[model samples]
Structures are given as C-alpha cells and as structure tokens.
Target: MPTQAHINMPAEPVRQTGMLRPALTVFVGLSIVTGLLYPGVVTGIARTLFPHQAAGSLIVQNGRTIGSELIGQPFSDPKYFWGRLSATAPMPYYGAASVGSNLGPANPALTDAAKARIDALRAADPDNQAPVPVDLVTASGSGLDPQISPAAARYQAARVARVRGLPVERVESLIAANTEAPALGVLGEPGVNVLKLNLALDAAK
Candidate 1:
C-alpha cells in the first residue's frame, strides 16, 4: 500500500517536460520568421527596388564581366588613368582584403609609400612636371574606392594622352564626360570612374 502523500502527489514533478514543447514551438517559430522569412523578404525587396545594385553593381561589356563599379582596380599602365592608391596586402586593389594603411600623416611608413608612388608617377611621365593629386598619392579610407577625385583624373590626363597618342583635349573631354556628379547633387564629391574611362579609351577608334 502506498502512502497517502505519494498517491496524491503528481508523477515526474521534477522533469522539465512542461517547458519542452513550448520552447520547441517558440524556437521553430522564431527560426522560420528570422532565419527564413526575414532574409527572403529583404532580398526580394532589394531585387525589386534596385536591380543593378542588387546584382553587385557589375560592369558588363559585350556579355563579359570586366569588374564591379564598387571596387577599385590596379592600373599601372601610363596609358590608363589610375584610381586611388590601395594598401591591401599581397596585391593592390585586392577585393577580399580591402584595408587602409592605417598610418597617420606623419608616419614614416606612410611618407615613404607616398614618396614611392610619386616617384613611380614621375618615372612614368618624366616630362610632366605638374604637381600630383593628393588622391593619387594616398589611399582612400576603404582602399577600395573605384572612383578617383576629378582633380586626380585631370592630373593624369596628360600622361594618358601622351602614352595613348590621343590629343590632350580629347583626353580632357573624356575625363569631363566620365566625371560623375555628386549623388543627389550633394551626397558626395564628384569622382571619375577610372575603369569606365579606361574602357572607353580602349573602345575609341
């Protein structure tokens, strides 16, 4: 015969079964809403609202992908206009490793790198004595800026014109044409898309 208290008391009082089902249900619901539904809706909205940007702002020419407008490229040829300096390790303009030199203005390493860039530019075009643009000698904050300041583009115009055997006026006109105005007329400074301009240069007859 069992005791009166044991007979009256509930079985498995210490087991956590009470919370197990509710917790599982809540977990499944939250996972569905957050992990699946939320991302799906956001992606759909982005694809619908901004297809170009949603597609990575890719620059396609002749059914081939040249690059993305969102990333910088290394252009060392004197015939092409170089964009801002990239401090990415292992390679210049390495997409996966976008990073600035993290050096202050007075840092000796920074100064040496800037001097090297200046020397390279001078060596490429010995006769051009114009002061180089600051953007050309310095890397942008992200080290992945696809566009260069308008002044930077203009600074390199003569060198590109001379090497390409194109008229300087023509090159300047190209620069003017490629110069992108500030977004919404106020969001950012005017910049020239270096890759597009170089592509145009190649396409010209």
Candidate 2:
C-alpha cells in the first residue's frame, strides 16, 4: 500500500479571529462618523442657519419665556382663541408626551367626544347661532398643533369679543391679521396661530 499523504487544515479559531478584527474596526469607524461627527455637523449648521427653530422657536414676553411657536398651549379662557384639541396626557398640549387620541372616525368614543365638545361650545356661547367648526372639536393627529383653521378662529370671534368686552370687528380684525396664507399659495389652507393671536389680543388691551 502506498504511504498516505498528510495535509494541513487551518484552525476554526484562526478564521474567526481574522473576521472579528475587521468587523470591529469597521464598527468603531462608523460609530465615530455617524454617532459623533454627523450629528455635530448637522447641529452646528442648524444653529447657524435656523437659530430660532433650533432654539425651539420660543416666544418670550416681559423678559420671560412664555411659550413656543411650534407648540400649542392650553387656553380655555373665553377671552383667548383656542387651538386644536390636544389628546396628549396627563395634560393637553403636553409636548414631551405628544400623542393622538387614536380614535377612528367610526368609533363611538370619538363621536361622544365630538358631541361633548359641541355641547361645551354651545354652553359657552349660547347666544351665538353659527355652526361650530369641526376642527374646533377634533384633536389633531399630533395633538399639539399650535394653529387652527381660519374658520375655527373666526367661529369663536364673537365669543372672544363678548368675553373681553372688545368690539366684534376688532376681534375679527385681529383674526384677519393673524391668519396665515397657504405655503407657496396652494400647499395648505389658511390658519391662525392661536398663541400669536392671543398675544396680540393682550397687547391690544
């Protein structure tokens, strides 16, 4: 019988070691670039180019931070314009806990909620005969919308005017002045920033 030939085989440990080194190097490199460098660069650019937005678009008054233009504040007083209903909890317009009510259109809970809102509005301004705007009763998708439809704002104009003892025309004028046109003239319907409108109303007083 012929003598058997011997062959060498690479160990499994050696192959694994070869693969692990490059993978670790790649992971470290990518982590530094994406996790550190990329965010730093983007934040720097945002601070430089859009400082107000980068700073949360805060609105200051009397040397104090009152609110942010990007977020809605709860204004239940009849003298102020109301923004969209917030579903956030444990309070409305709670930015850190922003969320929707998640009730579908056909859900009975949603219908009941709408009915309650309508009843509240009717109770608040029993003399006003105009129909309540739907947006006034519905919580927005994000539940933190700081703006309301122009129609919604106008619907409450008479109530605000009566509550503040201001003329209806003056309140309507404020609404007109605060109303923002659609972006690029066609992208969105007109809306009024409730915070700004309420601030203007205060300033007017």
Candidate 3:
C-alpha cells in the first residue's frame, strides 16, 4: 500500500503458442509420404515390370509348385546332380534357416565334414577318378545356393549318367545347357542349377 511503488513492470511478451503445430503437421505428412506412398509405388512398379521375380521366381510343374529357382534343394540320390552343402539346420535348404556353417578353414569340424562328404561322394561314385570339385564338399556362404560351379556339376556327371543309364555325353550336354553364363558376361563364374538339371534329366527320361 506504500504506493506499491508505482513501479510498473512491463508485462511479459505473450508466450508464442501453436509453434509445435506446424512441426507435428510436417512430421505426419512426411511419415505418410515416405513410409506408405513411397513403398507402395515401388512395389507396384516391381509387380508390374518383373512379375515372375516379384512373385518369388517360383518353379511350377503340373500345376504344383516344385521349388524356387532361387533356393536350393537337397538331392542325395546318385542319379541327380547335387548342389553345394547346405548348413541350414533341422532341414537342408530350409529357407527360414538360411545360414552358413560359419566354420573357419582351421576348424576341425569343417575338416571332418569335408572328409565325410568326400567319403560319401567316393562311395557314391566308385569310378569317378577326377578330383572332387571344392564346391562339392564346401557349404556356400548363404547355405541356400541353388547353383554349383560347372566343374562341380561335371564332377558328378559320370555318376549321374551311370545311375540313370544315360550316356556321359548326354549328361554333359545337359550340364552345358543348364550352365548359366556369368552375369553381364563377366560378373560371376559359370554355374549349373541343380534343380533345373535334375528336372531336365527327368524330362529326358
């Protein structure tokens, strides 16, 4: 009451309101555009342009899905060409379990596995005098490799031919035909798709 000091203090500037509204609006807009719109457009384009690959590159026979060209299947029969060793667990070539053996060169487990595979191959083809191809005994990095080096295919050609009662020349020719050239003519080494080659063998019968 003592003249409340007639001292007047300037009122604080009105605090800025609604500054967050624009920021929130921008965040929502970008989320919708990038997360939803961008992916939808790209997927649609892929579906339209590369239908087969977009659909998983499936291989169908007689109205039934046999397998995918992109994934490997286990073929232990002597009459079929075998693919690389798969490290997938519980089941060979199980897509859900795609992985490498993760064994190093010095790992005894790897050495033993290679020896066992070599023994098995030798047992299967008692007459195959050619040195076994490395791919035949080694598991690929992904463990789901559908293809094998052409040399690996040839290593088993004689055995497959003998078992199927087909001429070695014919089996070799099939292998040649199934061999895929390096991508863009230089990206990768020649490889043969085991599943395709096996199916071709069946078809030739």
Candidate 4:
C-alpha cells in the first residue's frame, strides 16, 4: 500500500463590500424626510386651515389665556359648571397625567368613587333631583376630557344660576348657546364645551 499524504487547502478570505455604510445613509435620509419633514408640513397646513383649533383651542379672558378645550378642569364651586370626574393622579385635571380610572363596573373601588362624586354633586344643589349624568360620576377615557354631557350641564344649571344671581331661565339660555350639537348630526352626543361656556360666562360679566 502506498502512503498518501493529506494536503490542507488554504481558506479564502471573506470580502467586505461596505454595504452597511450606505444602508445607514438611507435610513437617516428616510427618517428625516418621512418623520420630520412630513410632520412639519402637515402641522403647518393644519394650523393654517384651522387657526382656532390648531392653536390648542384655548379660551381667553380679558386678554389672558384661561384654559384649553382639550383639557378638563375642576369646578367645585356652585358658580361654575363642573366637568367630568378626573382620574388624574396627585391632583384632578392633571393634563400631564391624563388617564382613566381603569375601574371596572364590578370593582368596589369604582362604586365608592362614583358614590363620593354623587354626594358632592348633591351637596352642591340639593333641590335638583334629576338623575346624575354618567359623565358627572365616571372619569372619561381621557382624564382630560373638556366637555360635559348636556344632562350634566343641566344638572349644574340651578347652582350656577343661584351663584351668579341670575334667573334659572337665563342661565339655561346660556347653556343652550354654548351647547354643541353632534357633528354633522351623527358623530357623537351633544356636549357643552366647558371652556367656551366658561368664557361666555366671563364675557357676560
């Protein structure tokens, strides 16, 4: 038998095409164009088209900015129309911390919270026995909801009237004026924009 010697072949060196450099370039280009430029253009157009809304729909009083229509506010006094109960942490109407209570109907905590809100409402105006509006007792999906249900608005009418020393009928009229109907008559329930209504109240003075 002849002895055969095994010869090892040299391995080929892998080549680097430098494709990653171009891939990164494409990524940066697309990110700037699609993310930054597109958003800036759209926002500019929106502001130009809808000045009031694009500018935060803020309510101003006597040259001072009071609040925005996009956020709720706590109005515990009898003089003001109360907005929805807020689930914001640390304080009510905390826009920076907008969130719902996440309390299910079966949750005892939810029940107790709702009861507390109802008690407060009743204490503010004992004469009005109308059923409490759901919005009044429940925190909205967004803790910063800025509108109040029409029923809630009506619930607070008597208290507002008494505090402002105005006739109930007159206050009701104001509420009516501030009430916004469903969009195109089919989108959502009729609601009273609290910031606008409060601005109207200020203007009345």
Candidate 5:
C-alpha cells in the first residue's frame, strides 16, 4: 500500500558520539578555569598582599573577639557614642542587612525620624544648648558607618561625660584621639570612630 520512495527511506541512526566529546571537554575546561583556578589565585594574592584586611580587620581584646573595625554597632546607651542610624530591622547595625531609609527630604517619614533623633538627643542632654549636628539627626547612606562627623562626636561628648562621671574634656580628648582623617587625605570627610572612642573610654575608666 505504501509508495516505493517512502518505503525505501530508512530512519537515520541517532548520532550521540561526535558532539559529546568536545562538549564535555569544553565544560570541564571552563569549570576548572572559572570555579577553581580563578578563586584560588585571587585569594592567594589577597592573603599575601593584605593579611590583616583579608582576615576581616577584627578587633580582639583580651583574647576575645569584640567586633570588626569596619562595621558599626548599635550603641543607644547614653554613655557610649552612637553611630549612624541603621535602616536594618529587628536589629541595628546588622552588616548582613545594610540598607537605607530611601526617604526623600519632602517625605514625612524622614521628617518624623529626624525629629525623633533630635528629641532623643535633647532628652539625653537638656542643659547643653549646642545645635544638634545634621549627621546626628539623619542616617548615613550605608547605615553601617562606623564613624560619625567630628561635630556629632562633640555634640554627644557632654552627655557621655556626665553619665560616666568623667570630665567632658576627657571625653572630647578621646574623641580627638580616635578621629580619622579622610582616606588618601582627600576622599571623604574626617570622621570620629564611635566604637573606638567608646572603647577608649572604657579603657580609661
């Protein structure tokens, strides 16, 4: 019943060999180059050239790890110098979840948050009449900034000194000592590292 031309055609055999070998070779070669060799070489170079930074720049005291010098911690206590307000939720200064409020100047949320910070600062030191630094009232973009503007540090010096029963001059001195200059002497504003200043206070005590 079938035509002779149709019946005469036979099924072509499935060819699996020729293409597979080269495909596997390419996959293995690329995997080795991208997954193993590249990471190993880069890690080796970083560890050799920058040992301390590669190890995370952690601060250890009395054989116990405190924290990293690179990340900020929440310090709401009046005695400790506070760092930038983090947008992280459930916890502040969570490096794993760095964020920003992303609120514009015209946003009511931003205004309210700034007011809250200002009120908190005022409540902490009612007697001192110095104007609150803008840095103190607003969160930095990263929300994990370890440093505050020198003015912000000076603004809180009085309350910290009072609460700790130390002279304000001493607290200011600690702030001055812990202050860091802009990177490469020109990249950013000079900032006072809050954690270092607070730790120096503890050491002084």
Candidate 6:
C-alpha cells in the first residue's frame, strides 16, 4: 500500500474567542443597567421625594449655611452643647476624613483618649453627678455621626443653659424638641441631633 500522506487536524478554534463574545455582551448590558440606569433612577426618585435629605440635610441660618444635621461639629465652649468626639484625621470633625479611631478594646491609646474626654466632661459640668455615658467619651465609628444619646444631651443641659443664660427647663425643652424617636419606634435609640438642637437654640436666642 502506498504510504498515506501525514495530515494534521486543523488546530481547534481558540476557546478564549468563544468566551470573549458572551462575556463582552454581558459586561456591556450590565454596565448600562447597573452603573447607569439604576443609579440614575434612584437618585432622581430621592431628589423628587426627599428633597431636603437629598440636598445633604444642610442647616441654613440667616441666609448662611452652618452645618448639616447628619454630621457633627466640635464645640468646646460650655455655652454650646457638645457633640461626640471625632476621630477624623488631620483635624476633628473634618467631614472629608470621616473614620473611627479603629482602636480595639485593649488599646492603651484609646483608653487614654477616652479618659481624657471623661475628665473634660466632668470638669465642664462639675455639678453633674451622673455617671458619664459611653457615647459622650468615645468617638463614633463614623466621625460624622450627628446624633448623641439623650443621656449625653441631658448631661450637658445645665452647662449650656447657664452659659446661654436660658433656664435649664427651657434648654431641656429644646433638647426634647430636637429628639428623634427610634426608627419604627424600635430600630434605633432615641437621640438628639446636635445640629438641629443648636439651630433651634440659636433661634431661641
């Protein structure tokens, strides 16, 4: 028999080429749906439905912007109700650097920082005999958290009232007015947003 010519089967088509087509189609479709359409629709709905919140919950005073009800600011004066300690880097209450102290329970640095805050709070309101609330001494996970525990608010009542020259009962009433009940009456704690209380306090002046 004559020798048969050696034949090589054509190389199998590249498997990657087959994968590329389906992958590219899926990627393009998903990008448009999720990255563009979904976000756009949600943002539009929020702006139309919750205009104040969608606009950063900004608090305006006398045609000037003061702060947002969603973020806290540092106030060291006895006349002003203090917010939570900010762990924001480079400076306290720097909204752009919202972050926590990231210190574990046993961290000495955290212990010292917290102790300092406790001492200051005690010093500021010497007559206040109630135990310091943890929220008053520790920085929140998000340094921008605007609200404080109702206990913390009450703790500062006497000092702010005295400095502002308002009656303690009046300041307490303002704090009550600024208090927001738990979401659905159970999801979160009853708290007072510092920005809102401060704005109302200013209006009271």
Off by over 4 Å in 2: 1-9
Listed in order, each prediction's TM-score against the native is 0.87, 0.91, 0.89, 0.87, 0.84, 0.89
Whole-model lDDT for model 6 versus the true structure?
0.89
Error of 1 at 78 (Å): 0.4
TM-score of 2: 0.91
Which regions in candidate 3 have their CA more than 4 angstroms from the true location? 2-19
- Lowest-sum lDDT 10-residue window in model 1: 6-15
lDDT of 5 by residue, 1-205 (tens): 9667655544343345667779999999999999999999989999999887888888889999888888888888898888877777667888887888899999999999889988888888899789888888777787788889999999898899999999989998899999999999999899998888888999986
* Model 4 stretches with alpha carbons more than 4 Å out: 1-18
Comparing 1 and 2 on TM-score, the stronger one: 2
Give the candidate number with the greatest TM-score: 2
Please write out the lDDT profile of model 4 over residues 1-205, one tens digit for every residue: 9899999865433223466668889999999999999999989998999989999888776799988877878888778888888899989889788889999999999999899999998998898888998888999987888899888888898888888888888888889998888989999999998867776776674
Q: What is the C-alpha lDDT of each candidate?
A: 0.90, 0.91, 0.91, 0.86, 0.86, 0.89
Q: Write the per-residue lDDT of candidate 1 for residues 27-99, one digit (tens) a residue.
A: 9999999999999999999999999999999999889999988898999989899888899978888888889
**Alpha-carbon RMSD of each model:** 2.8, 2.0, 3.2, 3.5, 3.4, 2.1
> What is candidate 2's lDDT per residue for 80-184, written digit by digit as tens?
887788899999999989899999999998999889888878887899779889998899888999899989998999999999999999999999999988889
lDDT for model 2, on a 0 to 1 scale?
A: 0.91
> Candidate 6 lDDT, tens digit per residue, 1-205?
9999999876456777888899999999999999999999999999999999999999887899989888888888777888899999888889898899999999999899889988888888888888888898889998888899999999899989987899999999999999999999999899999878887887895
Better of 2 and 3 by TM-score: 2
| Total colliding residue pairs, candidate 5 | 0
